[model samples]
Target: MSRIQLALNVDDLDSAVQFYSTLFQADPAKRKPGYANFAITDPPLKLVLIENPGHGGTLNHLGVEVESSPQVHAEIARLSQAGLFTEEQIATTCCFATQDKVWVTAPDAEPWEVYTVLSDSETFGTAPILATGEAVPDDEAIAVCCGAAENATAPGAPCCG
Candidate 1:
């Protein structure tokens, strides 16, 4: 099954967790130091809250989660055929999961990803290395991960907020 994913940036992890727990009537399915995710079946939503101080509390990125890597590739091909595929990440890890993803930009330059999670991981993935073999800085990586590139925001800019 596929589900809509909405990630949000919040200032306080604890407060956000409590609020969402109450609102959803359930605890987070996954929790970490600065992140929490509630996989709600009733609404079929994957709601993620990330603690990022200085970023205004707002929508971070939007995504569709599929069941398998093949589905991810199919979506990538479909989006590419439609001239929407902007970037692709294979076997990359983010948000405590290993995923294969393709990024597309909306009409307003908002980024959307169609992805499939492969497995859980203890840590967020390592720094992304560019094709030139140079490591992407953490700040830049965070921006890229959260779809800042589509809006032409600088690395570490308030893209989500």
Candidate 2:
């Protein structure tokens, strides 16, 4: 099965966690210092919240969480065939998971990813390493995830905002 993933940047992690917990009637499936994720089955959604003090209370990114790595790769190929530019991160970490992801930008500049999680990681994985084992620099990795690099938007501007 696949799920729609909605990632949001919030000012307060604890508060957002509390509110979403009540709203969804389920506690987060994963929680860390600056992030929380809920694997909600009732509504078939993957909700993620990250605390970013500089955020504008807008969306961080959107994604499709598929069941397998092949699904991710297939989506990547499909997007490329449709002429959308994509950036692939294989075995890289993000949002506390080791994931294989392909990121693309919507027409409205919203960042979207097709990803499959391989394993859990201890930290919020921001520094995504390339398939060739080259690590993307900190600032550049952050820009890619935060919509600055792909969306052609100012740094810190919301991807969907």
Candidate 3:
């Protein structure tokens, strides 16, 4: 069973835990100071709630765990067919280690990736530089926002604890 994890920043840990527990309709399987986790047995999603004192609320990222590299390729094609505009998919490393997979984006501007690495490492392969004339989709604009106007970029792209 693969798991999808989401990290959310909230103002209060207790309140957030309560709300999520009621929302998920089950008690968390794990709870620690300033952090809580609920594992959904239905769809099997693991949600992590972390208390950030002045959080200002923002979604850190979204992750999807797939079984293999072929699954990653399928996800990219699926994203493109859905018209979400993928920012060029490339074979690159991520997280400090185990950086093998593909990333896609949702129409609502959310990034989703299908990956299959388990260990945490300190180096991911560098992303290939996009050539000129590649249009960056709005969903993936956040990645190339810092003065990368020279290359035409695609959309879709993420990280974690």
Candidate 4:
């Protein structure tokens, strides 16, 4: 199934986890040192919480989590055909999982990604694609996931983890 993903930055992991668990009446699908994700069925939402202290309550990025890599590739085609700019990431690790995703920018500068998780990973990852649309180096994989401003020059075009 496909669901909308909303990634948020919170100040505290424990408190946010408790509140979201209560609000959604669901346990987190995955929880790590500074991260947590809830797969909520009723609303079909993927809520991701990243503990980024000063950015609390702020949105990290938006996305549509799909069922497979083909779905992600399909989106890349659809967006490209429509003339919307797209950055593609294949077999890249992010949010502690391997994923295939395509990124796009909204009119107001919000970053949105269409992705599918392929497998789990041991570490959190950054968008393999950098702001210049170049793949990030192996040593730089520890950067932020879905950084709000992925490209300092382009502003809203974000790199995803």
RMSD of each: 2.8, 3.7, 8.3, 4.6
On residues 1-161, what C-alpha lDDT tens digit does candidate 1 reach at each position? 99998878788889999998999898999997778889888889988887867563766778898999999889878888887745888887777778888878788766788888888878655467799999988767656554445432334533321
> Can you give the TM-score per candidate against the true fold?
0.87, 0.83, 0.47, 0.83
Candidate 2 residue lDDT tens string, 1-161:
99999988888989999999999999999988877899999899999887776673777788889999999899889999999898887886666778888888888877888888999988555655579999877656656543347542344432321
Which pairs of residues have clashing backbones in candidate 3? 86-155, 87-154, 87-155, 93-125, 96-121, 96-122, 96-123, 134-152
Residue range 13-123, candidate 3, lDDT tens digits:
799888878888989766665556676877688676656566516564466666666776777788779775555433444433354555555557555555665454443
Model 4 has a clash total of 0
On TM-score, the candidate that comes out on top is 1
In model 1, pairs of residues that clash are none
Among residues 3 or more apart in sequence or in different chains, the pairs in candidate 2 whose N, CA or C atoms overlap within 3 Å are none
Model 1 lowest lDDT segment of ten: 152-161
Better of 2 and 3 by lDDT: 2
TM-score of predicted structure 4: 0.83
List candidate 1 stretches off by more than 4 Å: 146-161
lDDT (Cα) of model 3: 0.54
TM-score of model 2 relative to the true fold? 0.83
Whole-model Cα lDDT of every candidate shown, in order: 0.75, 0.76, 0.54, 0.76
Full ranking by lDDT = 4, 2, 1, 3
